[model samples]
Target chain A: MSTFMQFITTGLRLGSVYALIALGYTMVYGIIKLINFAHGDFIMVGGYTLFFTIPAFMKLGLPGWAAVFIAIIVCAVVGMLVELLAYRPVRKRGNNLTSLITAIAMSFILENLAQAIPAIGPDPRVPYMLFNNDIKIGSFSISVATLITIVVSAIIMIGLYQFTQKTKIGRAMRCVSEDKQAAVLMGINVNKVIIITFAIGAGLAAVAALMYIAQYPKVTTTMGATLGIYAFVSAVLGGIGSLPGAMLGGIIIGIVQSGTSTYISSSMADTFVYLILIVVLMVKPAGILGKNIGEKV
Target chain B: MLNIKDLCVSYGAISALKGISLTVNDGELVTLIGANGAGKTTTLHTISGLLKASSGTIMLDDIDLQKTPAHKIIEYGMAQVPEGRHVFAQMTVLENLYMGAYSISDKKKIEDNIEWVFHHFPRLKERSKQLAGTLSGGEQQMLATGRAIMTNPKIVLMDEPSMGLSPLLVSEIFSIIKELQKSGITILLVEQNAKMALSIADRAYVLENGKISMSGNASELLNDERVKKAYLGA
Candidate 1:
């Protein structure tokens, strides 16, 4: 029973991080219909920002966690720049194939750029531990990092929901997603909304980076690749354009991965995770929560 | 108070609008009637700044519309009810109205405008919380009109407000357009249904193959032999 509880806690923690990252994926996809392959690299950017800023802040007598704000800002700026310089031009002239190729090219650029930077070479570095304490329960203990990750992610998700449902810009974002020309008729600056979307998506990836390091504590140029693939799978599983779907998909995937690792061979965990994706695709191509909206004539 | 002269638009190599000129006086409803692919939608799209004009001027009052971006055109007291009633399908009717007032920042004013829209569109009021996609076709048209009105613009460009609707619903939507015009808003209406458009419009222009083929008083055009044969089905 305790063993089961331990796996559950671990799963929840991992799921929270995946959910945060998956949100960035889903939101960008929702607004632009582009997969934003570079979204995962935003997480890597956040990790490196923290790696550089945490020690600098600690040296200046500031708490290491203060670097999180810096990481978020840096990632958001990077994300916006990527959108403007790399994606925007291609978006105007190209079809889905062109934009998709641009996104993939962006991902490669970010990964190789990080590797080429002398200060952030391909070597893996240990991240500063933000929360190390654990809470003891009957026969099982949960780390402070795990509790904080789950709680913070939940709060952010709720905040995001309210922003989308209740705010003006939020409504505009929804409008743009539904129909770009209609949104323009409503006086929405489609480009500005897209830039904001990239900013928010990248900002969330930064928070995911924080949660990720709390558990894995490793920073590398290619760290975002695996994490990005997992989170992308989570987003697809949830229904790519649906917010609640992404959250639900991430949790299910985390639990499945944890359960498989604990009971089955650990080496077979990724295999099972991928198998679930294939099964879901075959059964429900639009995903668990996605509605197959037909095109109107 | 909207004017367009010699407006030409091209989609890559193919021209959609060739030197089309028209005007809508303040508080008057002007209808542009044409068959499909006759540049009616192209005219509205150019006026709304959605498409670039190859040559000519679009003057909304004193503002040079050609210089304005698509999103900024609404701020100059002009809005469009795009063809197909493109309501935000995933949003609620009320939320759709809120999006219409995207240019206005005042909270109380937005609230007032929403109330005005609700007063005009009572059906929309009843389904304010319902997702727009779930609404019937006629209701979506009403919501689209209400959303454009939420901007409180001096002029509106409506594209095929009667498309794909039943005869009963068509009359209902025309009545709503009549009500909107009676409220002193300048309107430029585009429609394939010439009889319905002519019945309500003060003046009319007939477009064919990207040019203004004919222009006259709406009722006179309704009686004209050529218009009757080609459009009125008389």
Candidate 2:
């Protein structure tokens, strides 16, 4: 039972990070119908930002939380900058194929550019040990990092729910997602709403990065590229456009990975995640909570 | 007051509106009546800044609407009840109403407009929590009108308010249109139901093939021999 508990706790920690990243993918897709392939790279950007800032801040006698704050701010600005400079032109042209190609290109550019930069070279840098303690309940032991990740993600999710449901700007996001023309007719600045969406998604990626590094501690230029794929899969699993769906999908995928690694082979864990994705695609193409909207006549 | 002069719109090789001009004066309910493809809806769209005019001037009071973007047109006191009743299908009726007041920042004013909308369409109030997609055809039309009204505009552009409704619902909708005019709102109505539209309009224009074929008092057009033969189904 204690072993089972350990697996559950570990799975949840991984799932929380996945959920945060998946949300960025789902939100951009929901509003613009663009998959935003570069969303994952935003995490790498956040990690690198933290790597440089945390050490520098520590030397300047600032606490580590200040580094996290700066990293998040930097990532949010990068996300919005990507939207403004890279994505907006293609979106305005009304070319989905071009927008998608641009996203993929942006992803490559972000990853390769980080490697090419002298300061943030290809080598992996271990993050500052922010939470190193462990919490023992009964015979099972879990790291404080895991506990913080779960709690922080939950708070973020709750905050997101309130913003989307109760706020005017959040409502505009929903309106734009449903019908762009209708939203414009209702006097909504669709472009502004989209920019805000990108900013929020990127900020979430940064937070996810912080929590993610808490568990793994290693940061690499290519880390976001691999983790992005898993998060994208999670978004698809949960219904790409649905907020709650992204969270649920992340948790399920986490559990599956943990189970496979524990019972089967750790080497085959990723294979199982993909296999489940294939089955889901064949059975329910819309994902778990996604509504299959009929094309308006 | 609103005015359009020589508005021309084209979608690629096909021209939807060719040199169409019309005007709606303050506190008057004006209707543009025509058959399908007669440029009635196109005229409203051009005025609302949804479709760009090839070469024309749209003046809404002191503002030049021709240069305005679609999202900003409503701020100049123009709201459209679109032809097909384009309510946000996924949103609840109450949420849809809130979206209608998207430009307004005052929370109290938004609430007041919502209450006013509910007063106008009590059925909307009954189904306030319901998803707009699930509403009946007439109910959706009512919701569309209510949503537009919630914007608190000076001039309301209604495109096909009576489209796809039962006879009973049609009369109910027409009555509401009359009630809306009495409430001090200027209106620019576009309709394929020329008979009903002409009867309520303070002034009317007959559009054919993207041009103003005739213009006069609504009651005069209702009795004219040409209108009686072509539109009144006499």
Q: Which has the greatest DockQ?
A: 1
Model 1: per-residue Cα lDDT at residue B95: 86
lDDT of 1 by residue, A72-181 (tens): 99999999999999889998889999999999999999999999988997888898888889999877889999999999999999899789888878878888888999
Which candidate comes out best when scored by lDDT? Answer: 1
User: After superposing candidate 2, which stretches have Cα over 4 Å from the reference?
Assistant: A294-297
DockQ of 2: 0.69
Which pairs clash (backbone N, Cα, C closer than 3 Å) in model 1? none
List TM-scores for all candidates, in order: 0.98, 0.97
lDDT value for model 2: 0.90
- Candidate DockQ values, in order, are 0.79, 0.69
lDDT of 2 by residue, A63-87 (tens): 8757878888899899999999999
What are the clashing pairs of model 2?
none
Q: Give TM-score, chain B, model 2.
A: 0.98
